[model samples]
Target: MYQNLDLFQTSGAMARHAGSRQAVVAQNIANADTPGFRALQVPSFSEAVKNSGVGAMKMTRSNHLHGDTKAAVVARVIESAAEPAPNGNSVSIEDEMLHSVEVTREHSRALAIYRHGLTVIRATLGR
Candidate 1:
C-alpha cells in the first residue's frame, strides 16, 4: 500500500534516526547531574542523507571492511560532552534543551513530508 511505502521506503530511515537523536538527548538530560556522565548527540539527518551519495559505490579498498560498500544512510552519535567540570558532570541544561527543540522540529517536518507523499500516492491510485 502507498502508506506502507511512505512509512517503510522513505520515512522509515529518517524516523529511525530521529528516534536515536531523541533518545540521546533524553539520556543527556536525565544524566545532567550525574558525575562523569558524558553527553552525546546524534548528527544531523541532512548530513547522513547527503553522504549516502548516489546509492551505488565502487569498493576500492584492498582489505575487507565490515560495512556496506555502497553508502547506506546511517546515524552516528558523537560525544558532545563539555570539557572537565570540577564535579565531573559536563551536561549543560541549556544546550540539551536547544538540541531537543531542533530534533523535535526536524522529526515533525519529516513526518509531514512523508504524510504528504502518501497522500499523493493514494490519490494517484484512486484509493
Candidate 2:
C-alpha cells in the first residue's frame, strides 16, 4: 500500500501531526483564561517520527548503501512546564500564536512534498 512508501508515510504523518497540533494550540488559547489550565503541546515532528515505530531501513545502490529509506510520524500530548500565572493558567497567547504559525508552515511543507511526489510519478508515467 502507499502507506508503506517513505515519501507518503512521512508526508501523511507531518500533515496529521500538524493538524492535531493546531487543534491543541487552539484548545490552549481557548483555555488561556481558565483556572488551573496548563498549556499543552504536541511532540515535535522529529519526536513524532521517532515515537511512531517506523523502524530503521537500509538500502543498497550497487556499491552505495542507504539508511532510513522509510519514515512515519505520530504525536503525543504533553504539558508545558512554563511558569504558571497566579490564576493557575499557563497558556500564553503569544507563544500559542507562534506555535500556530509553525504548525501552519509544517503542514504546508508536508503538502508540498506530497504534491511534488505525485507530480513526479505522473511525469514518470507520461500521463
Q: Candidate 1, residues 95-121: lDDT per residue as tens digits?
A: 889988988887887788788887887
- Candidate 1: which pairs clash? none
Judging by lDDT against the true structure, name the best candidate: 2
User: How well does candidate 1 match the true structure in TM-score terms?
Assistant: 0.76
lDDT of 2 by residue, 35-107 (tens): 9999999977877767765766654355556665444455789998779999999999999999999999999
Ten consecutive residues with minimal summed lDDT in candidate 1?
Answer: 1-10
Q: Candidate 2 has which clashing residue pairs, if any?
A: none
Clashes of each: 0, 0
The 0-to-1 C-alpha lDDT of every candidate, in the order given, reads 0.77, 0.85
TM-score of each: 0.76, 0.82
